[model samples]
Target: MRKILIVGAGQSGLHLALGLRAHGYAVTLMSNRTPDEIRNGRVMSTQVMFHTALQHERDLGLGFWESQTPRLEGLGISVADPGHGRAVDWLGRLDHYAQSVDQRVKMAAWMETFAQRGGQLVIHGCAVSDIDYFADSYDLVLVAAGRGELVSMFGRDPARCAYGTPQRALAVAYVHGAEPRPEHPGVDAVRCNLVPGVGELFVIPALTVGGRADILFWEGVPGGPLDVFHGVTDPDDHLAVVLQLMEQFTPWEYARVLNVELTDPGGVLAGRFVPTVRRPVASLPGGGLALGVADVVVANDPVTGQGANSAAKCAAVYLEAILARGERPFDAEWMHATFEAYWEQARHVTKWTNTLLGPVPEHVERLFGAAGRLPQVADRIANGFDDPADFEDYFYDPERTDAYLARAAAASAWPGVRGARRIRGA
Candidate 1:
């Protein structure tokens, strides 16, 4: 078996480790914490995965929450104006549903799952200097950790990175007793309350530590009133801050969480990180190279909810690249090519995410406005979250948007073309 070392046990690391292990590679996964520690530790993220990424998990037999987790059938998008109160809102249906499995539960189970699959799961915190020494032993080393000393191994690719500062100061909490939406009634879709000029509030149904629950994800725009959760250590305090923010801005959501409480003491987290992309290969002191994987290379803000999905796709793409290079050296050249393959898919995600994090373009805003009136438009936008590849056709630019709308309008006028070919970017 060709020896492989995977650093960090996040979604990408575990997915790749298990996939490689099943393929008969001698894989050793380095994690900072054991299963119990992870399960009881602070919540890492609100991973509300859409279908494309979810299918990847099921293919790997890692969809343990499929039965218990709530099925998000669509996206309930409401653009609330700060001056005008409630504006246009719609529940756009998705062809395939999405699901959110709390990382606390998911990561913990995966660590144990990787171990049971004959992969070595080492519970030790790692640093760059440590990896420099370990890279000599393994045939290939892959770093997938989201943050910490391990993350610093990869240098920023200035040409690809867009933002120099954090776009949003995020505050997230998992809780129970969040009432159903009065509009749709039931956890059928991820309700995203878009407060224009402020930020976003995502109420996602999830399988958490305390069974089925909702994750109230608050993305506060810089210097906004919604960015008030910093320094709140107590879970109760965190919950209170969230409630107050909702009551002040998104009152409709506040009504649903009237009786909501923390899922566990370890369920609330508040922090900020700028979205970044870095060089995939890190040069070690001894002239060896460690390949950066997932967030370590391409980290995006959660505004678009593409973090988890992109990470899952990265692992699968890399696995394909590795298998194709059969009996060949996993050299720096191979690492760069492998990342380029993943980047082909991930670039769409990063573009969509970065576009969303900044000021909304008029053409894109026109799509959002039209989605409320047109079911086809709504469904396409809803499903686009699942597969961002579709975005290259219409979601990114003004000319494409105009072309898509023009084509749809002309088709509607004649009733001759029910389906028109997508407009490719010029």
Candidate 2:
């Protein structure tokens, strides 16, 4: 039996563990804290899993969505020009696209499934030290530690990479039951609003085990006097600025939940703005001859809300590669190629999303401007999420854009109007 040791009990770690065990591997999962402790203490982050990623979960028979996730019908996106206090709504829905799942719940589900599969899970904290790979102590050591010390092994040299300026600071707070304000009436769940120069804010409905509704505010802080808001020590004061900015930037309906309180007192829910960066994959001293599987190798910005989905997708791919090699000697070349394949698949999507969130590029701005004037164009953009390949298709293939744009233009024309003629004449 192949013995696999997984470090960190986060979503990625748990997913990989359950996957390996199901394949008949002997898996031992270790984490620093007990499951209950991690569940109760950790602050929940907003995670939106796309349809493709969900399919992977279902194929793995994880059954996470049957009970835990909130099915979201569509996305409500608003673009605002804060300086002029002008905002426009760009609404789109997918028949079967994405769902919001509580990170904590997802983690718990994976852990439970891993255990039921006869996988050994150890709660004792174990710090991994540098080791000789040829020693037959273990078959694989996978690291899924997020933002932990183990990441140092794969860390990149800062001097070699070109990093962009930090766009905006993000402050997230999980609050319970501040009723949706009038502007945000009948708000069933997730909403994203752009505050122009100020930044973008997302309000997502959270699913907690207690059935109490939770609110997550992802506020973007652009440079200037607004930068001071980043330093405010008081949560109330910080929240006030968020509300004021929202009210000024857009005609958003938001209810102030007077009774709502934060889950954390010290404001551990916050994280600062950081440029999105990816470290090139490095081959660890492992071939099938060596005992140790590569752990978490990818780190992405949460701006696109693809972190969880990407992690899950990568896990699935990695699982396939492992199963393919079977008991054969682990070929270092093949393992590196497997990692690169997943990275190549994910890079385009990540870049497209980051570009969208960063200062709107001219081409994108023009595209949106046209989309606003042309409903058909808007539909194509909206349906972009439904495309199986998503941004990947749009980014990697220049030809695909033209085809998509043509379809968009055609769809945008008002009923009875010839879109081809309209574009030809213009």
Candidate 3:
């Protein structure tokens, strides 16, 4: 069996590690944190998985919280006016539910399971310089560091990278006692409120350390009001500021979290990251190469919530490619080809995410406007979160968008759909 070393216990790295081990490959999963450390640590991410990604976990027998995690049945959007309250709002009901399971619980459980399955679990902090040692020992090294020294090893592919600087200063907090949706009390949808030029606020329901909780994610534009967290350590202080920001910008969300308390004393994460796309193969000092997986290769902004989903798909694709190689040597060529295959699927995700990060164009704005009343158009956009590749057929550019609008119009026979078909979706 070929030895595969996976660094970082993130969605991609751990998924591939476990998949390889199940298929009888020698796999080593290394991470800096233990189950106890991670479970008790500060919140790592507001990771919500769409239909396909959730299905991948189910197929891998990692559906540990499928029954407990809150269902994100809809994607709600409220375009807030600076002083006039909500200018426009609508809910896009997802055909299938998306779910968010706190990484603390998820990753810790995964680590414990990998160890039980006889996979080597190494708890050690790694660095860029450590790539050489890993490459020399394992037949192939997969880096899914998410963020750390291992990330720098993958040279930025300028052709693919969209931004030169951090797009949004992100702040996330996990809290219990948030008010449920007024209309559907039992439903926990991903409720997003956009303050046009300012930033975005998302309230995602997740299963955290204390069971089910809500994640308030703030994507503050540079120099914007939401860009408030600086050297903030106290969770109470963070939550207080988060509440203040929401009250000032998105008051409706403020009402939802009126008396909500932080889930953990340390459950606050704040920072900024430049969304980057890197070359899949990283060259070592001694001419060795390590393959990059998921975020290490393509890091998307959390605005679209594609980070975890894309990473899960990357693991699935790489596992299949490796198995198909059979007895072939794990050469540089094989690595490049394998990454290219994954990129074909990933490109759509990258493109869609990039489009959302920017300001909405006129044509796309109209689509959202129409979605307020049209169920078909709304559902397509909602379910698009699952298979972003479909956006290429309609949501990416003018010609395709027009084509999709036509189909949607003809299928509905509603005069409203006909008017929408005239203009394209972005």
Candidate 4:
């Protein structure tokens, strides 16, 4: 049996371990944190798995859907003009094909399933250092070690990367028993608001276990923002500030939130700014290879919430290539080809998502503008997440640009308005 050592216990690492074991590979998954540590650790971001990712979960028979920390049937997108104190529900009840779960619960469930599948998981105290690979340590070593110092071992010149300005900082808080508005049942569970010039705020309910909800706020800080504890340090004071900010953005709807009491004293509220980076796959000296995956490969702004989905897709593609080359020498040529294939598949989605987060490109802006006026156009965009073929078109073929644009234009033009405009312009 071929032996494999996976260097991280994150989502990709865990999924890979399970996939390899199913294929009759002996795998030793190593991580720095134990299951208990991950379970009790502070919850970070929320992940909405696309249909393809969900299929992977089911294919592995992980059986995690029923125990999902939360489930959302639809998504709501709004644009808030904080300066005018007005919010427009730009897109409501869109994207019905996706579901979200707390990152913590998903991780815990994955670890449990991996262990039950006879996969060996070792929680070493810290990261593993450089060891002689050819010394017969293992047949293969896969590095899924996320974005950190661990990425440097692959030895690539950092100067070759294209870096962009840091995006806004994000602060997320989880609270329990937060009542919902009668008019907007479970609104918090699926709503995302783009407050231009400021940032975006997403209220995702039940993102954690025990009926807890997440209040995610992103602010575009070219430099940074003044430290404002949203009652995290002091409930009475921070709560006041958080409510004030919410009311300032969506007074008519969020006013009710001011009355809700925060019950979790130990609940999480934290912030950080993320810089976007993209680098080419680097080849190691000894015909071994090191390539970035997930956020490390293409760091996308969370405003689009496509990180987890993209990572899952990347892992799936990599797994396919590995299986295809069974027992083949893991040489530089094979590694380069695999990395190229993965990139080709992932580039389109990554670019589209990243562009959506940045100042909207003209084509995308036009699409969104038309979507606002056309329900069919809006539905197409929402349904695209569930249809991998549509996603591929959007990413892989620039020629489809006009087709998408035409659809948007047709949707945007009112009855009789198209002819009238053409006549007038002519």
Candidate 5:
């Protein structure tokens, strides 16, 4: 049996570990925290998995909280108009529903599942030297940890990296008592509020440890007014800061969060990370190579909310590569090939995400406005979250954007499907 050591038990690591186990390979999963520690810890991320990623989880029988999590049936984008509330607002129904289960609840449950399935679970804080020492003991060592000393083992690929600094100052708070969008009434949707030149506010429906909740996340442009969550430690203070920002920049969203309270004292996360793409194969001190997976290799800003989705896809890709290799040595060449296969899909995500982090392009901005008038346009954009490759067709180029819009407009003219003009005009 091939023995594999997977360091870092996030979405990718754990998924790959359990996957290899199901194939009868010997797998050892290493995590810095225990199940209880993770479950009882501060909220990790704002994740809403689209159909493809969620299907991958269900394929592995890892969708334990599927029924409990809110079914996000659609996605709405509201571009804030200075002091005037929303300038362009519309909701696009997704072809398939998306769902978000708090990482604290999901990861903890996954860790326990891996152990219960007989995979070796090691609770240890790993470092470069530690991976070097254990490199010879396993047939493969995959680094899924996107932070700490392990990430440094993989050098940064300057050509692949777009930004040298953090793009957005991120702050997330999970809370309850938030009302649904008045426009969409009983429909649950992910609300994305774009404040030109400032940042964005994303309200995601999720299931946390405390039950059904909402994640009010802010992606603030650095040095901007929204970039003020630096030293707020108290949960109430954190919640207060979040609300104040909402009240100021996105008052419409604030109306929905009026009586919201933290799901738990540990339901807040505030931090920032430079979006990076590191070399896939990391050279260990002891002459063994560790392959980087997911965010470790292609970390993009969460502005597009692709972290967890990308991680799930990476794990699936790596599992396929590993299974195909059979008894072949998992060498540096194989590592690069595996990541490249994944990158073919991930590069689309990286490009789309990086594009959103900067100033919105004229054509793209025009596309957003069109989405409000054309339901087909809005639905295409909404479902693109499931397969971002669709964006490459018309997202960047002005000619292609215009062509696609014409096509969507023509399609909307078909009988029984006239596009809804949903934007609220000032």
Candidate 6:
């Protein structure tokens, strides 16, 4: 059996480790913490897995919380006007539902599952020297941890990296008792409230350790009014700051979360990271080559909510590449080609996500304005989260955006036809 050692047990690392184990490979998975530690630790991220990404987990039999998690059937956007009201608003139904499982709950369960399946689980933080010592023991070494000393092994690729600094000051609070949006009563949706020039607030229906809950996430433009959660360490203080910002910038959203409380002491997270893309193959001092996976290679801002999805897709792509290699050595050349294959899909995600981090283009704003009047247009945008590659067709270019909107308008103008056009609310 091919021996593989995976360091870091995040979504990509754990997914790939379990996948290789299922294939009868000798896989040793390393994590910084055990199942209990992870379960009781701080919340990791705000993830909403759409159809394709969720299907990957289902295929692996890792969708343990599927039934318990909230089924987000729609994604709605509310653009806050300068006057503290929404200038543009609409909800777009997704053909396939999306779901968010709190990383604390999901990762802890997955770690236990991997061990119960008879895979070796080592609880240790890996450094450059540690990996160098173990490089010769395994047929392949993959680094999935995107932090600490291991990341410095991979050099940054300046050409592909868009920004040298963090794009948004991010803060998250997972709370219970958030009421449903009045506009979409009884319908569960991911509400994205965009406060122009200041930042955005995303209300996501999620499943946490303490049952069903909502994530009040703020993405504040640096040095802006919304960037006020820097020193707030206490959970209650964090939620307080989050609510204050919401009331000031997005009062409509504040109405729903007035009575919300933290899910747990560790339910709040605040941090920022530079969106970067690094060289796929990292060179060690002993001339051993280690392959960087997922966020270690292509880390994009979470503005478009693609971090977890992209990591899942990267794990899937790398698994296929490993299976296809047969008896061939997992050398540097293979590593580069594997990441390139994944990048073909991931580049679209990176491009779409990075585009949203900057100022909204006029053409894209035009598209958003049109979505309120056209159901087909809104649906297309909503479903694009499932596969961001679809955006390359009509998202970036002005001509393509105009052409797509015109087509949608003409299709909605069919005369004397019942249900030919569904004009959703604005």
Identify the candidate with maximal lDDT. Answer: 5
**Candidate number with the higher lDDT (1 or 5):** 5
- Residues 335-396 of candidate 1 have per-residue lDDT tens digits of 99999999999998898899898878889888888767665667677778987878878888
lDDT of 4 at 104: 68
Q: What does candidate 3's lDDT look like per residue over 313-425, in tens digits?
A: 99999999999988887889999999999999888888998888888766676667666766677777777788887676677676666666556755666554423423334
Over 1-426, each residue of candidate 2 has an lDDT whose tens digit, in order, gives: 987777778766777888888889998887777667655664546666667777877887875555655555455566766453434565444435566665666677677678878998877655434322422456655666655555655555354223455555666656666665454354343466665556666766555544444545555655643454646667776656655554555444344544556655432255553444434333355432222222244444565566777777778877888788888755556656677777666655556565655566555555555555655444345545434245554433446545656665655444643233224211
lDDT of 3: 0.84
Better of 1 and 6 by TM-score: 6
Q: Which regions of candidate 4 deviate over 4 angstroms?
A: 67-70, 82-87, 92-96, 125-135, 154-162, 181-189, 224-243, 259-291, 361-366, 385-426
- All candidates' TM-scores? 0.95, 0.80, 0.94, 0.80, 0.97, 0.97
Model 1 scores a TM of 0.95
Task: Tell me the tens digit of each residue's lDDT in model 5 across 132-233.
Answer: 999899999999999988998899999999999999999999999997678988889998899999999999999999999999999999999989988898
Give per-model CA RMSD.
2.2, 5.0, 3.0, 5.5, 3.1, 2.6
Question: Model 2: how far is 1 from its true place, Å?
Answer: 1.3
Worst 10 residues of 4 by lDDT: 417-426
lDDT of each residue in 1-426, candidate 6, tens digit only: 999999999999999998998998998999989999999999999999999999999889999999999899999998999999999999988878999999989889888899888789999978889899999999999999988888888899999989999999999999999876799887888888888899899999999998999999999999999788888888999999999989999999999888999999999999899999999998878888899999999999888898999999999999999999988999989999999999999999989989999899999999989889887787888988997888888899999899878777777767632233233211
Candidate 5 residues lying further than 4 Å off, grouped into runs, are 416-426
Off by over 4 Å in 2: 65-68, 83-86, 130-135, 157-167, 178-189, 212-214, 219-268, 273-296, 372-376, 379-389, 392-407, 413-426
What is the C-alpha lDDT profile of model 4 across 91-191, one tens digit per residue?
42444345666666677767777788888887774332342342146766667776566565544433432334556555555555455655556543356
Model 1: per-residue Cα lDDT at residue 358? 82
Cα lDDT of model 5 overall?
Answer: 0.91
